[model samples]
Target: MPKSSLVAALSALALTGCSHADDGGPAAIAARAPLQWRSMATPHDRDRLRDWRKAWKTALPRARAFAPERTAAEGALFNADLALPGATPPIGEYRCRTFKLGAAGPAMLDFIAYPWFRCRVTDEGEALGFYKVSGSQRPVGLILRDSPTRAVFLGTLVLGDEQAALQYGADPNRDMAGFIKRVGDRRWRLALPYPHYESLLDVIELVPADSARETP
Candidate 1:
């Protein structure tokens, strides 16, 4: 999916009454400051698989016992220009950054705000999908820290009616607890499972060219 399409899909979701304006103030203010989207950086290592597993262990203590059993075929590797269903056109680019998690290990973080979409089977085996436009419901964004550990963290902002969001967030079937128990802290993790291998685009700020700008 193109970045424009992703944005359109997300906007449509919002229009469908999936999100409520922040209760603090005027709706216009809320419109000006939409959600923000970002992802954790990718670690650079000769043994990425090993690092991933280690990270997962740090974040998820019971990973060996509770983590979803995924074959290499089931795992999807994402690039800077990955696209998904319902993505907006003109997918944006991304800025990758690396961070250190102290003794826990080195982590990578990427801040992206472009058109992206994802449809995945949550750890609990339920279907979870999203069409992301500008920002993300997840605060810290998606974290893919250690390779050997295969630790991953995701923060999301709940969209849609309170009931729907809450229901998904609290879904027991999804293996959300294992993921959250390892990484959930100041940033809350939804009890619901999130789709894996969702599509994503680059990050780009929307700004009209000077030629298209009106004269002052």
Candidate 2:
């Protein structure tokens, strides 16, 4: 299929509703979140999060080969093992940008850098609510505290003007799982490995929205 047609098809799928036994409201979503979030992710996502280091290793050089300046500018963001101690970010608005590395197919670009977008980290009783408020493909979900240096992000993508997001485990195609880590003083990164889209890994760099209105 042509690229436009493929995108249109994906948008259609995002708007369609599918019944799921596990799908429920926010409270219910939080209730199932504990250690169960790991099981909620697809098998591939599980492996992706587990072998995230490999994803970075395979993607960085490939991305550098094509967009060396852009890739090099990322600096510490590309370091897979540079996670800081405090993985949890405070409740507030954040400025985030996306860097997609390693093309998944011939039609995709080797590296793509998206401009700044608005994101929010809310205090959702059981887990923090992470929402990419502005973007064509928004990911809204719960951030469960996993360890001292990391947190597990379990969420699904919301496309276009869709008001509702799919349940995390409802659709494999829409499901998103990643690890959130604080990389700098007030900077954090969400590392999503082996995504189901155009890139092998998706790194979202985030910082307080109050900072300079530029890339994080």
Candidate 3:
């Protein structure tokens, strides 16, 4: 074979081997994406939240009866002094926004005109148990599972209080959950499938409340 052809063949082989090592298969990439929100807040290219926000608003009133209910048992689960970052919302008020792990994302999600939850903590340690589900002021349960480094919060049911943390855990296989990776960090994602099942969207973002002019 010609020297040039031989060299080209070697290069192609090297490239193939490299790609196989980091194949970046679709499922593998998507799997790591959920954890990516811990450091960055990337939104999907289409920003489906814009479209879904409208749908959430349209269905808010009607979604009440179908809303998940928060129970007394859930509140006692993580009530202990568990060390988790941003376990409590934050000192400054923040509004929850949709979060993702891809291109065209927001550093601080917009708290303006979305199913966002606006909240704040105090100087003393006040942990955030749960926030309202999208659309309505009612909370869709947050079950806590604490680890040495992170706290796993599963959104299970609905809380009646408009401005309180969800302090419990219930359904597991039938709930959507998120992890707070940072210690005392409030920036996390909540993959909520509220109003109904089959809506496993990850567009939620948690940004400071006074950070912007957009208020509910």
CA lDDT of each candidate?
0.24, 0.77, 0.34
In the predicted model 2, the residue pairs found to clash are none
Backbone N/Cα/C clashes per model: 56, 0, 25
What candidate 3 gets wrong by more than 4 Å, as runs, is: 1-88, 99-127, 137-149, 159-176, 182-186, 191-196, 213-216
lDDT of 3 at 144: 35
Task: Residues 25-51, candidate 2: write the lDDT tens digits.
Answer: 433433443434564455666877888
Q: Which is superior by lDDT, 1 or 3?
A: 3
Give candidate 1's whole-model lDDT. 0.24
1-216 per-residue lDDT for model 1 (tens digits): 322232332223224333565443332332354422211111221223224334433433222222234111112221111222322211222221111111221231122112322221121111112222233332222222223222333323343332212221223221111121111111111111222212111111111122131111
Give the top-scoring candidate (TM-score): 2
How much is the lDDT of residue 7 in candidate 2? Answer: 22
Backbone clash total for model 3 is: 25
Cα deviation at 53, candidate 3, in Å, is 25
Instruction: Sort every candidate by TM-score, greatest first.
Output: 2, 3, 1
